[model samples]
Target: MKVTQRAKWRYQQVRQARRQIRYKFKPFKHTRVTRRALAAMVQRVVDQSQRYTLRAHKTRQDEYKIVINGWPDAVQVTVGVHSLSFLVMQHADFCDFLLWPDCMPRRKHGQWRCFDTGCLASGPYHRLEDLLFNHLAEPFLEFLTKVPEQAQLMLYDMEGMHHACVEAVKPLKRLDRPEHPVVCWPLPAGSDIV
Candidate 1:
């Protein structure tokens, strides 16, 4: 029987993951804690985060950016108002998504006054998942697969939202640019759940 290199590599990866899970989780098993205590700890962690949602109607049509973390290299991609126009910067980054401009068009007389969809529909914005898969997926997977996961992947946008959780997925009306963009963060255990 012959084993291909890919199969051998996968087997090794599975073994490594099991070993890491056992070693890392051992501490939690030894420590005895009540349900109330566990709840308190979770609450504390939730309190540390500033929670908010990024709205699709609020995103800038003129600009779209995605920031990836856990990579050794600094990576950022931005798509401007023009079609097929984009900028990729290495190592230049921002933690707050609120700093970006609000490109959401205002409604005037029941009609949207801003050109939000046109710009976003153009350029490389549509290929977001693809771009990340090509350039950043390896490192991201490595980060996820590593032992004692310490790094977190976050998405930020112009709406001052951070640690967003997606509650729904829907399609856009026209241009099919994107739809139902929402962001949410974990709240305290007993607090209002998003």
Candidate 2:
């Protein structure tokens, strides 16, 4: 069998077209959480938490910033007319995570937004606290627990931040160990000698 150059070109073109069509029709794997949805999650966490206090203050003409203050850290959520920005602060450690909305067309230098699909999706989270606790608090705590090793090779790092990491991990030290059941069983009299 002989294949012409024109036939080979047509075959490649058909394959390229099929690839494009498949790419265009592919389903999105995850859903994005909008500003309002994130705000509601933060509000719910604040409400359910006994140790945290919520405060609201007007930031702009129509924008309001909600601040959640408590033990591990504090979260500042800026609710604007069309966008939302979140800033989670570990006051003692001076470490913070600022997350801007993904909907924004442009972002300033050094700005970051959430990139985790599971964290942004509402379907996986039955209660808002689960979303907030797992995504928000857990990440910061994990970072705090690793600061010392992460900064060990650095020539210079913030002393206070290291101090804060110690303070944060002190209470959580017990969690690093596995608990063993304490049980005592009396050996039978006829059992073999040890």
Candidate 3:
């Protein structure tokens, strides 16, 4: 018996279909971090701090707002199993401050796009904990304490602040700095932030 070209092509198609079905039903190995767990982590960090009075309140099913008393604005954080998003809201405008697991491409105007499942990294919980303490909380506290006035100014001038922040971060990307410490904001002529 001779196998014709048509038979070979049909065999390949069937094999491909089976592979697709297997992938569609494959059990996900990595467990997802719950919103409540993420919120509790934030609370622990806030409790340890002494500088600012920060309170984490659950505003939605998957979102929490960190309210800082005596501050001009509130920080909104959304947590996912694989990603975290930080935003600051002032009046009616908002700023996308940072995105964790920094693998996703940034959108135009310096905003970060959502995480892609294909870019998921191992030990997401550990990475997120580090980011929460070092990247999100530490820099945020510094921004409030070191330059309280500047932080307020940024909230007022959202567009200019965003542009400055985008420009400030461009050099860091090229330099590949491990820690992001700068909070770029508008300043008077001949004045600089050190």
Give the Cα error of residue 8 in candidate 2, in Å: 8.3
Lowest-scoring 10 consecutive residues by lDDT in candidate 3? 163-172
Taken over the whole model, the C-alpha lDDT of each candidate is: 0.30, 0.39, 0.44
Going through the candidates in the order shown, the clash numbers are 5, 0, 0
Which regions of candidate 1 deviate over 4 angstroms?
1-66, 77-86, 90-104, 111-113, 116-194
Task: Put down candidate 2 lDDT per residue, 1-194, tens digits, no spaces.
Answer: 35798899889999999887774222322223334444555455445443334565656544567664422224456654234555544444443334454221112232223334533442344443344445554443343234332122111123332211222112334333334111111212111112
Ordering by lDDT: 3, 2, 1
Best-to-worst order by TM-score is: 3, 2, 1
lDDT of 3 at 180: 31
| Candidate 3 lDDT tens digits, 1-194 | 35788899899999999887773222322324434445665676567545556677776665556665544444555543334455654434335463333222222233223244554332233334443444344545455444423342233243344412212222434323333323334422112333
Residue-by-residue lDDT tens digits, candidate 1, 28-142 = 1212222232233223322332321111111243334433222322233343322111122222343322122223222233332334463332223222223222232222223
Cα lDDT, model 1, residue 173: 36
Looking at model 1, which ten-residue stretch has the lowest summed lDDT? Answer: 49-58
lDDT for 76 in candidate 1 is 33
Worst 10 residues of 2 by lDDT: 180-189
Native-vs-model 2 lDDT? Answer: 0.39
Residue 192 in model 2: lDDT: 17
